[model samples]
Target: MSLIELHTRSLELAAELIDTVQPEQLVLPTPCADWSLRRLMEHVVGQHRGFAAAARGAGPDRALWRDAPVGADPGGAFRGSAAELTAAFTAAAGTPGRSRLWLPEIRDGGPFPLDLAVGFHLLDTLVHAWDVAAALGPSSAAGIAAAVEAEPPLAGALLAVAEVVPAAPADRGPGRAFAPGRAPATAAGSFGRALALLGRDPDWAPPAR
Candidate 1:
């Protein structure tokens, strides 16, 4: 799948999971430590906005990347942000030149190549989609399936970017984004391996209430 296709599918899966979230589930714990479902949604919305801004050549504008507020209607808010992001990416799909993405989190604030930037976001969306599905507990078969479908494309996208994207320093440790984790013996599928590569325990599940 093309980067745009992968990104579009990622957003679709994310939106599906977001639509499943109930008000009571907002406080549920996710695989991402210390991030509640609501908090995770905030991060997702913020990233979409930031990426959208970057696609529009406003990569350096920090203000456009601000964390989106999760109001009472979290799903509605997410849908809006996702729509904006998808539109931006779709609009930029055929444009010339590499898209500049401002990534302040990295050591050198990067205006990274467009494909690389989209691939990075695609990776995050896949993993975070799993986080949400896992948080939804054992009943989330559809969500799990969506995540599984996302794996192969995600792997392909990451592999393509790996050659151009510099490897993180060894000393960066396990907590860094994209750090590999110990894959559980039971982690058999592509999604599981992808999760392990992203420093997530594929076997992780929310504690039973």
Candidate 2:
């Protein structure tokens, strides 16, 4: 599949997992160590807004990137943000001279190539989808894993980005997008290594309650 297709599938996966979140689950602990599900959802929604603005050359604007908390309807917020992001990316893909867009929130406020920028968003969407599914419990994670399997193109492209994600140990931590780095498991598959590189344990699960 193309980059746009992979990104679209990732967004769909995120939306699907987010739609399953119940009101009570919003307070549940998530894979992101310091964030409740609600906070993580806020960050995800904010990213959609930020990236959309960046795609339009309107960004590097911190306000758009900050966590825009939801009121009573986090799911509704997510849908709107997702649609905005999708539209922005789709438009950018076809427009000339928009190939190198400015993204203020990214490291050093990048003017990254459109394809690379989309990959960055795609990987984030996929990981956050996993985070939400994990919070919903193991069955949800397994179900989403199966859903991803049904779309081989997305899974393959997701791993490709994960395995080659650009980051250094010094660049990861509490205030950053990724957690502290762990030693990569040489024997593991690309997915496992990718998770490790992304600072997530390949076998990580929520604590048993």
Every candidate's CA RMSD? 3.2, 2.3
**Ten residues in sequence with the least summed lDDT for candidate 1:** 158-167
Off by over 4 Å in 2: 181-192, 207-209
Per-residue accuracy of model 2 over 1-209 as CA lDDT, tens digit each: 78987898888777877876778778888889868889999999988998898888774668878887866677788889989998999999898888876777777887889998898898888878878887788787666666775677777777778767657766787777788656777774444455677887655677777
Write down the lDDT that model 2 would get: 0.79
- Please tell me which predicted candidate would have the highest TM-score against the true structure: 2
Over 4 Å off, model 1: 145-147, 150-155, 158-175, 178-180, 184-187, 207-209
Q: Output the number of the lDDT-best candidate.
A: 2
What are the Cα lDDT values of the candidates? Answer: 0.70, 0.79
Alpha-carbon TM-score of each model against the true structure: 0.82, 0.89
Which digits, one per residue and each the tens of the lDDT, describe model 1 over residues 101-182? Answer: 6766544758777777788777677677777887887557345644555577655664444333344466234556554455
Q: What is the Cα-based lDDT of residue 15 in candidate 2? A: 82
Clashing residue pairs in candidate 2 (N, C-alpha, C atoms within 3 angstroms) = 60-104
